[model samples]
Target: MTQHFTAPDRLTAKTGTQWWRDAVIYQVYPRSFADGNGDGMGDLEGVRARLPYLRDLGVDAVWLSPFYASPQADAGYDVADYRAIDPMFGTLHDADALIRDAHELGLRIIVDLVPNHSSDQHEWFKRALAEGPGSPLRARYHFRPGKGESGELPPNDWESIFGGPAWTRTADGQWYLHLFAPEQPDLNWDHPAVADEFRSILRFWLDMGVDGFRIDVAHGLVKAAGLPDIGGHDQLKLLGADVMPFFDQDGVHAIYRSWRTILDEYDGERIAVAEAWTPTVERTANYVRPDELHQAFNFQYLGAPWDAAALREVIDVSLAAMRPVGAPATWVLSNHDVTRHATRFANPSGLGTQLRTPGDRELGLRRARAATLLMLALPGSAYVYQGEELGLPDVTDLPDEVRQDPSFFRAAGQDGFRDGCRVPIPWTVEGSSYGFGSGGSWLPQPESWGKLSVEAQSGDPDSTLELYRRAIAARRAHPGLGAGSDVRWLDAPEGVLAFARDGFVCTVNLTGRLVSLPLPGRALLASGPFTVDGDRFELPGDTTVWWTV
Candidate 1:
């Protein structure tokens, strides 16, 4: 039996005036985005060279993962020097040039900032270690004495998000807290010096002409007073669903409020984005409360199942949460830490973000394309991860010996298989590394990726790359898209979702069979082929269509 959905009335118009509110930001993972020096590793120069690609793709900004001076222990998250660029990624001059070039291309550059931890090799940590116990330098971090009589046990029962104990004992018998790897020690946010140093670091980057910062682990900067124990095992699974003493603490908001002050001092609309994983969308909203950050990543939307009801519910809650605070909701499907959405939607629900089994590739790509259209029709800013526009799926066949994710080495830890999503993207149809670099990529590219390369898809109107280009162009030209704060739900049958914004309507079919729906307006775009009969349109399964009334 065919289901049908009737059109609904249009809603009052609500617009987003600020650039960040309705911006389309592209995330460039520097390690795999492109390699310009033939060093097999992506560098700042590579990003500069690719600035035009981004501008032509229609994204308003680029959010780059860290390229700071690091030990490469956690892919640049463990910063050895916040003020310097890693030699592997190029010099400080390269960063300045990239930022300048990006600005000249009419794009903003947002660099990653790791405030929760610093590399053990950082000068401050080195000095703290040499100063021994009770040194003022040690006060800058969470250094505490062990609990057992012999001081052999860790201070508390807390567990690292990456697995194992959260505390690592030092040579002097004192223990330090690290929610991630032992080489990345947590900073004591309560210390005035810690706060002051971060403020200075913020200024240093702003002075470098970078647009803003995408704060890493933004919710973990402050721990509850007394560093209370969570008293539970397998705590990694509870993250973003339950509150712990170590994360989403109220004190973190004060830190962001201070950072916001620094951001406002600049000429441009410099912003701070929180990569916060809180228990609820409402709790996530707190991170962007007027005086705090400008946006928080919408994980609720990203993690929702492919079911229409589930997606609609997530959208409703997300928009409601961000409304009172006057912050635009941010939508993202995939990132460095999670499996690609194409692969995710291809499989069944409850498979988690790190997939060990490859699902139906064709099904996944179809759903992913439909999902992209639906996301673009939504009211807030959207983030497109590098390679997602190419319809790239996670590389699930990497050998164990080639894995570099720290979580992969941990037992029973947070899904450590993030390496599958970090594989280098293909640029050309043929080459040692598919034209990623002359020296080959740091991570090997799959032979299958050649068919999906930019060179292969550039001119094909049916390619995912072309679909993205057209959708982004339509969003820019259509006044109804990317402006409103809410969606008006229309009458949709089960397994289908339909909504209307100002002068625009979007309908998605999530069922396995074709469904008939009233033709509310002229079709503007579609994820797949469809048929129209008189005033009704036949929407194919696993498809989305955008319409203009």
Candidate 2:
């Protein structure tokens, strides 16, 4: 019933290197993308078929979320086979073919590597459960003898991210640890077999023509040696302690150093982006040194407020955190985990509102256009989520019954599922569901997205798709925006956030009121170009203007 997964016939498929500096990475959620073979879920062949579309979008790289073998407990995060692709998504041949296809279309492919844990049903875990302490596989995971009533007193007070006891009682009155869900058991990194197995997994994919990997939960690999109880945060959760001591241990860095050696064998060009959510910039930089990982996302920017003051603080924190490491910085305003920018930043009343009216849609289109400039204008490379380039807002009203993501489910009675933004993409304009597939989707389609399909907006010059194209072209044309690491915060009288790079200053009117700012030099870029004069530049509503020199 299983097919063999041999490493790709070709490993060095890419001729050119050092493509990360100015690259724009487009992230794809495989489940919500195009579904091939008439399956409701997206698969590898479907991603291969869409390579041309990504190439046309002018993105340099495409990061495919986990396609590895899974039980779909955590939507592929609970990997059952690290070396093979999930049968639901596709076969090994599809992965090999996908790499070649993506390369042919001038795109780099990065797959998610979930190293933190594995599905309880994984082979090793099954062996551990069957043989108990006598099994060689018992050491692969964290299993301990029980104490108190039904193993109620866990080794530690650390709570699972899913909101319950991190330890689960086994049939023999022992507790097995899982930082996420009971279905996913935490692996023992100190175990030699675990490290060797992970390295072997890396070699399997790297040899398979895959470009690189995006490591999931990079910091959560190694826990405290004795598995001590967490001590704080009682007021917040009425549960697990704030256990700071158990995380980011010194031994974790040693594991990363070893992984760097595997990457080194392939000429060290294969990039690894860490999903390291360590709050402080200084602590997060440990995973992104010259050897550990090529880059690590600083989530400070993702969770920052929409206003200027908070954003500026995040910018400062990021720069300050990375100043010592000498690694390139990365930035993004949105991702798969959080609320969509449209609902979070635009709506004051919250998620349930009439914000999808025709007028609201037009206004959102304009703000999205302006946000494009700001995203690209920042110091580092930008990550644009799927359909974000087309200004797709979170419109799908997800019913509580169909929620999928595990993070929201663990939130105890809270409607924590983020399936609202994970709705299927619209490929055609003939129907309300936009012909994503032959039948109903895993998510209910928003009526508002009927007119926003790629098919309908492809040739429209004023469409957000065209605006993204123009904005990307402009950012590339003037390298100063991406270059010139130094930024000078410019002072403006009104509620404006202004900055200068490479002798060029850009001022934005974040508020609805009209305002003007005097430019010392001639015009290079303007919000609504023809509307400006020689001295003072008048900015229309929620627009940002950039300069060349």
Candidate 3:
């Protein structure tokens, strides 16, 4: 791969008591990030080609979604081989090169590690199937005997998170559990071999110079003592809102404690981040309790509405929970699994029943820009999802025929269906795939996306991409931005959120009408134009401004 930009090794800077506390990490969904080799699918080479871009964007790290060897049953979440890279994404050499390239650009790399389940095509699962019931190989997974007069019924009433029954009967009459798609079998975390195997996998990547890992389904690694029934319908929909027997069980903490030891063993402050969906912020804090993982993604914040009251409540609760555990609160607005915040904010209610509509994009972009500034100004690390910096809205108009998300066909109700946010991002304004690749993209880019391409927004100061670049740069330069742990809630009007951290203050106006708010210091950044009169500034509706006190 041709090198774009290089810098002296800065991995050592990542060391310190809590480097992750206020870090601005960028999430790169590999399949949609960029494509290399004209295959229409993003590869490690594509990521390598874009390292300079991420570096210039001023993010502390790049958290890559899964690109491991898989059946693509769930878009690489189903891992067939933990150590090898899928041919579509490139070889192991490409992965190593990407890691090396990222480090040289002063950017850390965090790859996804899925331990909750493995693709049925995995050698271990294949062996378990060939060996049949009562085989020792089956001990590595959640294999069990069927329950019924003729063993025709499922082992339990537990439903798959993706829909349907969780247990699938093999040709041998035995049943295995899969919380997701049947192709992705849940692993038996109780087994020592499972733990040992994962530890070995962690070491393999760590040895290859990876900075850290984003543990997929981090909370589901350990299920309840017995394979218990959920005993209710739509159990998947209750995830993160209510506790289920299969999720957020106390048993998972033990596994993380052990993994934390392995991470601490490596230099460069190797870390583990949990993609956990707990019932409460306190439960989420359990995953990052100093001895466990280093950070846990705060989905509550991501799900919060644009209303000031809701956003402030979530922020206060999140900070309060993490403070006790001595873990930094992590904030994220969007990811590959959910609706993009730009489109989400456009709807006054936040989540939409239908798809995007007229007047939605304008309102959404305004709120999204305000929300991005608000999230970045908060005291903690923030995650920037790919394409979000370019103000990409969710592709809600995607035809059902081209849908690839497993949840689209399986899960009913309001859960799943993540394909809209996973569309390939536009690079150049004019190309078959908007310069995403030389060939047709896996998912079609919207015709209007040409106006939102990186090339079009690169130099525009008012553009979302430039706003993100400035916000990140300011965060890196300002001592009070990313390193602080708590924000002192400043008294403000009912429809505004005002908080001061260290010597900096941020005020966001969420009200429909304009409001005048006192500024503590010189203006550092503002989401939009504001009127200043004396010590008070007129804050426009859905605007955020940062001031250096």
Candidate 4:
């Protein structure tokens, strides 16, 4: 049996305090979220139609992935026009209407801002190419002469994050740098024009009523002086674990500080979030200092294993690191970039975030639910990836021909398997796209997904969807769940984790064998069935429970 709670009223647009400090923000991948025009791809109108569902789901904000004008080279991350909406996604009028509709429903909007690079077809890049070498326009980007006698080799040894050399030679015999795909050219942040232009861009959107911006590749904005060589192999493996000349540079903090000042100028507690991948949690905290951005995504917690010890260590270290900066720690389980947590937990341990092999489905889902209970109980703001509430697993069997991830085409590239997690969500039990749109989905969905659709789970008490709704509502009603600074750890078995926050307690059992212990308090919620025996209760393996003393 599943517990139930009366759904809370719609969230207010802005709370009396800093809403983002402990808000639950949902990430909507626009390309696959919904489609209103039946064109098969999701659009702003599709998202507009789904606003009611999100409002009913109990999240405070919606963080939209890029919908800006682009050639779809790298899926809108490569921006050609920062101010215009992509034709496929609809017009500027549609964006305005969407923002208005969201606000009316008390949902704040956070748009993604990709400043680290721009589409090769952007006006600035085109002009730089036309003006040839030494052109003033070329100063806005990292264009340099190649090495060797004939200038045949790339300017430096730096490699593209998508595999192959980072430098691409132009017809004019000069090479340009791109950290990701060749179509996305890295910007020269040292150039004053880059800074001035982004400031103008920020004001443009803020004036249009956007609540905030999610800075993409936030750590890669400013490169090391002289474009030094990393002089290493398998460079992609070093990301988020070791420092490099091109990422997490000290100068990046200055850029965020400037953006933070602009954010402060706005009303309604507008915020800026950094999608920075730093080598350490302490270093990640640097981006969220009082004078800098409001929040940085806690990837460290997202990548932790299912083990109790590992999760506890990450929780303690993360909180300790953010305590000094006075920034609320952000917790996230799955996102657009990595494998879904539901599927990741199903497989064997040590696979980390990228798991290519399949695992036991039932076991994976059980642990995933247990993990969710644990995550929501922690003190801080939390991010819910699209479709995660439905316990959607990664669509791991997409054929190679249908795959569109740029990394998939390049050898030695970062795991090209991200497409597995970006499939359009199923909303109904039957439809060409499972109620995602009138037409077929851009990526094929499994036949088994019909059972997982929102329609299928709406009234079912044991559904994953219901669990999320209850958990979120519980979090909102309880004062100790969110915005707290720390948690008090309680003594438990080696593979079990128990903690208290105010009058609430969360206990997770990670071992395969059931454990008997004294009842903590009145049971508020449990991930699975439990057996009560006198003063003690038997907690099943891979389960979590919430208690209210």
- TM-scores of the models, in the order given: 0.96, 0.89, 0.96, 0.97
At residue 36, candidate 3 shows an lDDT of 88
Predicted candidate 1 versus true structure: per-residue lDDT over 1-549, tens digit per residue? 111112111100111236788888899999898888999998888888888888888888899999999999999999999999999999999998888777767788899999999999999999999999988989999999999888999999998888889999999999999999999999999999999999999999988877789999999999999998877556887899988899999999999999999888876678899999999999999999999999999999999999988998999999999999999999999999999999999999878788987799999999999999999999989999999999999998888989999988987677788988899888899986887888988887788999999899998999999999999989988999997699999999899999998899999999968999999899999998999999999999999999999
lDDT by residue (tens digit), candidate 4, 66-132: 9999999898999999999999899999999998888888888999999999999999999999999
Residues 1-549, candidate 2, lDDT per residue (tens digit)?
Answer: 112232222223323445565567888988887777556777787788888988778777889998888888888889888888899789999988888788666677888998889998899998789887667787888888766665567767677767777789877666888878788998999899999998888887777756678888887888877876657555224311222544566677788888878876774266778887674767788887776877788676766554667667777777666656766677875667655565555654234222232225555555656666776777767788887766787754566687787766675422455676678888778753576666556677776565788887898876777767766666666756664345688888656778877756666666766777776455555434335576666777678777755
Worst ten-residue run, lDDT, model 1?
6-15
lDDT per residue for candidate 3 within 188-233, as digits (tens), equals 9999999999988998888887878999999898888787887665
Better of 2 and 3 by TM-score: 3
Per-structure clash totals for the candidates: 0, 4, 0, 0
Better of 2 and 4 by TM-score: 4
Stretches > 4 Å off in candidate 2: 1-17, 235-243, 349-366, 411-415, 520-530
Give the C-alpha lDDT of model 1.
0.90
- On TM-score, the stronger of 3 and 4 is 4
Stronger candidate by TM-score (1 vs 4): 4
Q: In model 1, what are the clashing residue pairs, if there are any?
A: none
Flag regions of model 3 displaced more than 4 Å: 1-9, 350-359, 411-416
Instruction: Please report, as a residue range, the 10-residue window in candidate 2 with the lowest summed lDDT.
Output: 1-10
